[model samples]
Target: MGEKQGMKGYKLAIGLAIGAALLLPSAAGAAAAKPSYELEWEGGGQSSGTVIARGGVSYIAAKAIASEAGLAISWDVSKQRAQFDGWNKSFAVRVNSDRGVLDGKNTEIGGKPFVLNGELYLPVRFIVKALDGDNVKWNARTQTVTASGLGGYHARSETHNGLTFTVVTATGELYVTGESGESRKLADLGDTIYGAVKFAFYDSPGGLLHLTVTRNYGEPMIQYRVYTAVLKNGELIREAEAGYFRRFVDNATNGGGQLIVTDGRTLELVDDVTGRVAESYDLVKLGGEEDDYFVEGVGPEYLLIRPNDRGLLMLIDRKTGGKTLLYKELLDKLNQEYAETNDVPYFGDWLRFVRRDGDTLYFRNDAPIQQDNKLYAYKLPE
Candidate 1:
């Protein structure tokens, strides 16, 4: 009986030891895993490099690097060769099966080298074109980049009402549609037309379409001011004076049936029936200082405004002067995460709140917000 009891105790101890040994490896593995990229702004340019052991990648913008070795080159670890490309050129490169680098080159500009995180990364335009084809174009005026021959893909450049517009298309019919029930052949713009159209209020409610027409007065002193025009039945009529307006940030119809314009520091709440200002106030004054306050979006019930340097968001009621905070704690959390002192990129600023469905606010950002190479989703508290 004593021997049997001793054998049972030994077996139980062995089982416990085995279970702990199995858990130790898993715990170590979980602790070792981390994000694959790190983003840092060094000088001015931006570049990204892969991390080997930790699997952390680093990305720096184009303006951060000093000089390049003929378009920075990185070793293709998967294929075991050197690769290169252009900075800010919309292209990608990878190693071929034959141990050769495959890439499309942009024939327009020469390549430059960029260093990031102690490693060199070349622009994709040089490498892709060198290995693949020479069908790539970049339009700086419109801020667009394009490549063809790999199934032919194009992306249009879009922005708030501005002087510049850019788009990229390859061998396909370009279509232009307007809210004013106007359709025009985009090819008619020009042979080198490479961007999207910039109008004052295509995406905004009660917004007008403004077009820039350049005429040669044959005099060196030619002055032009930005003008607003209402588009109806494909015709521009009812012109309004927009004083040195840079661009339309956000415009919407309020609950009181008025159009609110968030133009820089001035917030003009216009009467819906008449295109006249009903009530207007300087947002800078409300914020207690001359801060860079811009209206982000205007919902049916609320107006979202971002005050510069405050890092705190404010919501104004359309009906009353009552103000509420939308996830102030989240903004604080983001600031703490970045360890920023004055200004940090607010996820709310990047995102456009579209609709309030149930208890959630649906929003989308114009550009991809990335910390390292990995993506992050913004979460607001209830």
Candidate 2:
């Protein structure tokens, strides 16, 4: 394979001098030269391990090989056998044995296996070539190795129709692949990604994908930013200038969801077109012993609220100023069970469960012994 130019790593010109190196005597001598290759993972992350020259062959660290190639490898110390699996192929070998088998074919590695510092080492060039039978290239001159055509570290995956969306956690890059074997990078989100990045798909006028990226600093007082991006014109574009949200909008729609910014007292429902507050809901004083309350979401008729220490979920009618307690039994049951606060959703909202509109809501018990996963129908107040 040709080397990608302007790539800080990999020199495609020197192709490992494989033929010439294989001609050397198989017995490695104390005087023979052993060198380390700089390992660079696709899109980032770099590490290097020494490649031992033994019996005229090159042996590499097993863990290093598995990581760089994204292979799942396990060594059976008792049997002296190591099994390697990746890229739809499997290979097996025994330490100190060159007569290995890959995909039922007899194979010989670059050198006799060696062990260094309690880690098993195997033939370097042979294992790399085994990944799809020759998609990787090594350079003896630069001592750099490159593996091409392998999928990225598949951190998360979602399938719609025949297209699969995968996220590479090492880098926040997104990729979409279809059944036709055609694949493309959906978003080049860079290398400095932190925490879980969520994607919401919408098949509106045209197909659109929304990405919500969050980075948690793990402190209660310091503010954090939540960025929303949309796939527009085949590009991932940020919706608005990323602003820190006091109250984040839980986009609970199948295709399109509205954004609401709040200052604890006044909730501003923003118009996506005007980028201004189209309407506002000020927190009204419903006379009671209010310890702490949160504005959950505003519907066409009522606003959802859960105030106090008991996890009492209530809905306040915006027009009538009447409050209806929707879910009190389950929340109280769960809170009393755990001796902690538990929250549940009321009826007439899509976000009652799993960010998908559903009539059923689930309340999970956190006790280690019980391990209860309670499901309840979103019940309307009588």
lDDT of each: 0.41, 0.52
Decoy 1 TM-score against native: 0.32
Which candidate number has the best TM-score? Answer: 2
- What is the C-alpha lDDT profile of model 2 across 1-382, one tens digit per residue? 2345634234332444564466565534423544665544455555566667667566677776576655677778685888876433577888778778887788876566666678888766676666543345567754545444333233556676566666666666667777875668766555644545555554334344544444333344223344344544335433422323222334332212344444334445544443444666654364143333445555555566554234445567767768765444344554444433322321111113322134333434333434446554454333
lDDT tens digits by residue: candidate 1, 84-200:
443223333332212232334323323343444545443434432442334545444432333332222232434333322223333222234454424443322222223233333
TM-score of each: 0.32, 0.38
Alpha carbon lDDT at 7, candidate 1: 100
Cα-based lDDT at residue 167, candidate 2:
62
